[model samples]
Target: MSSKRVVFDFDIAFTNGGGIQGQDFRLDIDGDTITDKELADYIVNDMQLLMVRKVDIINKHYITEAHKRKPVNLKADEKLVDLSHTIFDGLVTYKGLPAPIICDYLSREQSKVNYEEGTEFQIGKITMVTNTGTYIDCPFHRFEHGKDLSEVALEQFADLDAVTINAKDAIEIGKEYFVGKELRNKAVLVFTNWAKHWNTELYFENHPYLTGEAAQYLKECQVKLVGIDSHNIDDTRGKSRPVHTTLLGAEILITEHLCNLDKLPENGYKFNAVPPKFKGAGTFPVRAYASLG
Candidate 1:
C-alpha cells in the first residue's frame, strides 16, 4: 500500500515555560491511510513536544522526510511505585458492586478475515461501576451539583507535591496527624496498610479510615487531593459519610484503595491519580502511582 501525504500547521506549547516557543510548522502525513487523530499524535510524540494545542491542515499531497526526535530518558535514581490494584475478569473490588465483566468485544481469531495474513487484534470491553478498584472522587460524588470528573482540572489530579501519613494500626485517623504539616496544593496519601487484605473477605470489614475532623483539616489546608489505602475514606458501617462530605464539599479530590505506600518516602515525591475525562461521572478508577525524584 502507498502512503498518502498531507501538509499541516501546529502550535506547540509546554506546560513549563522556557522550552520551545509556539510556531506554525508543516508536515506530511498519510492522510488517506491514517486517521486525523493518529496523525496529530504522531506529530506530538515524534517532536517530543509537551502538548499540541492546535492543528490545521494546509495540503493533502506530496511526501517529505518524517521528522524524528529522541525520547526522554529516565534518571538513574528515579523510582515509580504502582499504587493501584489490577482489574481482572470477575474480580471483586468492592463488596456490593458487581465485578467487572471483562471479555473480548472483537476476538483476535475473528479479526483475521479483516486484515492481511498473520495479522490479528483483540478489542476488549469492561463493564463495572465507577467505584471499582483504586478510584478518585470529585465533588459530584458527594454533592448533587458539583464538579464532575470532566470538570475537575488536570493539575488537581496530576504532578502534585505529595506526602504520606503512616497511620498503620490506627482505625480512625484524626486531625492531629496533620496538625503542623504543610499540605497546601499537595496530594495527601494516608498509609494505613489495610490494603494488605485486598481481594479478600476481610477487606470489606471495619477498616482504617480518616475521621471527619481530619477531612475538615485537609480542606482548611487547601489540599489538592486525599488518598487512603483502605476500604473507604469514611467508616462504611455508618450512614453519615462525613469524610467524603467534608472533603468533596470543598472540591478536594479523593483516591481510595491505594497500595504500595511502604515503597514511598514520607516526602520528596510527586503523586498522580488521573481518571478518564468522563462527563457527569463523579467517580472512576485511576492508575494511581508516585514518582520519586
Candidate 2:
C-alpha cells in the first residue's frame, strides 16, 4: 500500500529592501499558473518526487492592495527561529563524568585603580571538552590522518545546500532507506524524534543512530555533512562507532545533539552548523540553524 500524502497551500508575498517586488526574481512552480494542482502535477510528472499531492494558490494581493500603490522593497513578515539548544556547564557532559567546569569570569586581572566610575574588565574563558553540547565531529576526530577542524573547509560545514530526511517511522535508518535518494554534495540531516531528550539522562543511552550501511551510502554519494537530532550519530550500545567511522573517514562531518529539527520543513530550509575557527580542536559546539523566507 502506498503512503497517504497531503498538501497544505498558503499564499506568500516577498519583496526586497522594503516593499518593491523585483520582476527578475520569480517563484515559478514549473511555469504554471502558480496553483496548487498544477504545482503538484509538476512535481509528480517532471521531478518524479513523491509525498506531495498538490499545490494551490490560496490567495493573491498586489502591494497596492495594502499601501496605495507604493513601490518599496519589503519582505514578507517571516521570523527565523534558532534550532540549536543552548550550551551550559555540564549540560551535555559525557556519561563517564568527564564534564568540564564551565564558568564565566575574567581571565586577566581587573584594573585596580580604574574602579572610580569607569568600566574595566578582561577577556573571559570558557574551558570545556571538545565534545560538549551540539557539536560536529570532523574526520580527524576519529582518525589520526583524517582532516581536523582546521583541515575541514568552511564550505563543508557552512551553507552548502541542505535537505532533511524524516525517519520517524523507520526502526533504523539503513542503506536501503537512502537508496534512490540524491545526496551528493548536500547536507543531510536526520530527523529521528530524538531531540526530545536534549537535557535528560536518556539522551546518553542507546538512542537512534545511523547504521554503517547508511554511512557507506552517504559516503559513496559524497555527502558534505550529516546531522542528527540524537545524542550521537553512532549506535551508543556498541563499542565500535561504525557510522562515525564510515562517514568521517570519507571526509564527511557529523553534527550531534540538535534540537528544533521539527520546525524545519523537509528539503526546504538551508542547514548551517558551524564551529569556531580553532587550531588542533577536533570537535566543537555550534549554533545550528535554518533559514526560511
Candidate 3:
C-alpha cells in the first residue's frame, strides 16, 4: 500500500573523516510524508555506511511510483524465504556465551601494497562459539558417540519437505499441536514469534519452548528436523534439556533461533539449514531458508 517515494540528494560526512554524496536517489517511503530525520537514518542504514557523523538532505521531493527495490520476478515453482538471523559483532545469542568478535584481519586499504593499482580486498576473522547465531545441533551435541557435523548426511538438513506449527501466545508447546499434522520426514518449524524480542533482555526470559512431550511426538513421527523461532528449542530454565535429548538422540536435527517462520505457509515447502562440515564439532550456525512453490 505504500506507493509514495522520495527523490532527493544527500551529503553524508563520516565521524572519522571524509564524506560522500548522492543525488537523484529514489527511496520508497512508508507513507506520503517523511521527515529529514527518517530519510537520514534510512540512508545511513541502507547504505551500511560506517562512522556517519552527519547527513544533509537536499532538494527533497516526493513522487508517486512503485518501489523499485522491493519487487522481484521469480518462476511460479520457485520462491525462497530467509529464516535466520544475521550474526553481527557483539550479538549475544545466549546469556553466558561471549558475543562474536568479528574484525578485519586484512583490510582493503592494507591490501593495496600487494596488489596492482586500485585493487583491494578484505579478509575477516570471527572468534565465537559454534552456537553463536541461528544454529543446528547434531547428534554429537548430546551424545559423544553420535555423528558430528561432518558425518551427518546432507539429506538430514537440506531440501526436505516442511511444515510450520503455529503456537502463537503459547509458552509451552505440547504434543497435541502435532497429533493430526503430517510431520514424518518434514522439517517442522514452530512459529512462536519470539524473535520479535531478540536483542532485548526480554528475549532471554521465559521464552517459548517445546515441551518434552512435543519432542517425543516429533521423534515418533520421524521428522527430519525441528526448528523454532525462539531463544531455544527447549526450555532453558533448569539444568535439564529433554527436548534436545529426545530429538537429537533420534538423529533428528535441531535448528534454534530461527526467524521469519510467520511468512511461510502451513506446508508444501522445502526447508534447508545446512551447517559447515566441521569435523569433531557438534553444532554450528546455518543459513536457514525455505523454498516454496
Candidate 4:
C-alpha cells in the first residue's frame, strides 16, 4: 500500500490549563494524508495525552521525524442480533397495562387535497406506557429522587462487554450461577427462554426471575447492567420487590423482556439497550441487541 507523509507544527491545550506551544512534528500515514482535525486527534492519541481540549496546527510542510505505523483495518467480522420483541398495536406485554394505540395522525387519503397530484403523506402516532415492550429501568423506577432516564450515562446502556448465563428451566436465579465469572463493568444477561411465551397468556404467569441475593451479588461486583429474557426481573406475584430495589438502588440499569439470548456466546459479544433521554421518566422501551465480534 502507498503512504502519504505530512509535516506540521501544532499547539495543544489540555483541560487542566496546561498547554503545549509550537511543537513541530512529521508523520508518515497510510493512504491519503488526513485532515488537520484528524491529524490533531492522531497526535493527541499517539502521544497518550490526557484531558486535551484543542489541537491547533501551526505550520505546514516542514519535515521533522519519519514515523511509520500501519493503518488500522477497521473491517471486522461482526454480527448484530436483535433481542427485543416487536411492539404491535393491541398486543399486551404486561397484564394490567393498556396495549399500544397505533394510528395515523395524518392519513394518506386525507392529505390528497392538501398536496399536488399523486403526492401524499402519512404521519403516525403511538400511545403506550414506558413499560410496554423490551424496556430499561433506571434508578428512578424504584426511588422517587434517584437518577432518571436522562440522568443515566450512555456508557451504562451501550457497547458494554457482555456475558450470558444460561439459566433455562431455572425460576429463581441466584449468585451461584455467577460465581466464577468476571462481572465488573459487564452486561450480565440471564437467559431463561421464557420469551417463547411472548404475546401469549402464559408469559405473565409464574415467569422466571432473579433472586435478591443474585442482585446483591451483581451490585457488589459492580456489574454495569443486567438483562433477562423473561417476563419481569422480579417476581411480580409478591408484594416486595427486592431484586429491583437492590439493583436499581446501586444505579445498575435493568432490561426486561429481552429475547434472542441463544444467538450470543458467553463472552464474545457487546450489548446495547439504549432508551430515550426523557427527563422524569424511569422506565422506557429500548431496542436491545447484541454485537458478535
Return the lDDT, model 2, position 175. Answer: 80
* lDDT for position 20 in model 2: 17
Clashes of each: 0, 10, 0, 0
What would the TM-scores of all predictions be? 0.74, 0.69, 0.75, 0.73
Q: lDDT per residue, candidate 3, 1-293, as tens digits?
A: 44878899999998899999999988866657778887898778778889899999999999888787753112222489999899999999999999999999999999999999888899999999989889999999999999999999988889999999999878999999899999998999999999999889999999999999999999999998999999988889898999999999999999999999999999999999999999999999999999986
Q: What C-alpha lDDT does candidate 2 achieve relative to the native structure?
A: 0.69
TM-score of 1: 0.74
Q: Which candidate has the top score in TM-score?
A: 3
Model 4 lDDT, residue 226, Cα: 94
lDDT score for residue 38 of model 4:
74
Candidate 2: worst 10 consecutive residues by lDDT? 17-26
List, residue by residue over 1-293, the lDDT tens digit for candidate 2.
12212223333232322221212222322111244554335434554544443333443322212222222222232345466878776665467645666654753335535555456666556777888878889888899888788878898887657777888634468887677877889888888888787778877776788888889889999989899888778877769999988988888899988877777776756778888877777789888887764
Question: Candidate 1, residues 1-293: lDDT per residue as tens digits?
Answer: 34434444444445554334333443434233444565556667767766446543433344444534332222333488899998888888888789998899999998998999888999998999998899999999889899999999999999999999989879999999998888898999999999899999999898999989899899999998999999999998888999999999999999999999988899989999999999999999999999996
Better of 2 and 4 by TM-score: 4
Error of 2 at 92 (Å): 3.1
Better of 2 and 3 by lDDT: 3
